[model samples]
Target: KLKDAHCAILVVKMKRTLIMFSFILLQLLLGNSLSPKHSSPKPNAEVTVMGFVYCDVCSNNSFTRHSYFMSGVEVRIVCRFKAASSRTNEMITFSANRTTNEFGLYKVAITSLDCADVDSLASSCQAKILSTTRNEKLVDRL
Candidate 1:
């Protein structure tokens, strides 16, 4: 009788373990299926570079400091494509003629040709913002 009881207990424990493992696997599978995979931009990404050009040191003269502020600060986006399959640098320029708005806002829509080149593209691009009125020091990132 004792041996039978031990056998039954072992069987129950085994069943419980199997059930727990199945539940965990189901949860993992569900989570994976629901989540979206990491893919490249679908050639329809509306890339915009918008920021305020403010003098960090000068807060006293708002009007005079930004009086000569103009738009179109020469923004260029270089899309680096350095994948395992690619040998050389496959950089694509999204916009060059585009410039910032009146309130210091710039928007550049990437072309389909540029987006379709690489499977995975860089999200944001490094830019050198240069203005004639401001000194070279002000020609920082955007």
Candidate 2:
């Protein structure tokens, strides 16, 4: 009879422990749901510009032995607004400067946040390719 009583007590304790653990887990989940660390940006969010330089057949014609010409190229990837807005401008202001690799490929990345700093110089905004120096000859984009 004593052994049976002890087993019952153990079972009760186990149930209480499980209930407490579940309560703590529920609290944690609820807390996180209430306050997210990084809320998603609104639709038609601010522009994030990324510039990539690549060498392609500059000529309109198809690839040929002599047609494999290389030239420094620059491109802009605009983040356009999804919906039209009266207050919003047609295009966001963004610019980046970068030099191409030996194979003629370079890239730059800028965010709308960067534009807030009026004192920020143009050189500061440019994405520097630290690995490749002016002397270094790169075969492809890194």
lDDT of the candidates, in the order given: 0.54, 0.45
- Summarize candidate 2's per-residue lDDT along 20-134 as a digit string, tens digits: 9999999999989888589776543233333333323344334434333233533322222222444544433454455554445544444344223323323233333333323
Estimate the TM-score for candidate 1: 0.38
Candidate 2 overall Cα lDDT vs. reference?
A: 0.45
* Predicted candidate 1 versus true structure: per-residue lDDT over 63-85, tens digit per residue: 35444444545555454433323
| Backbone clash numbers for all candidates listed | 0, 0
Point out where model 1 deviates above 4 Å: 1-52, 58-72, 82-97, 113-119, 136-141
Winner by lDDT: 1
Minimum summed lDDT over a 10-residue window in model 1 is located at 132-141
lDDT of 1 at 79: 49
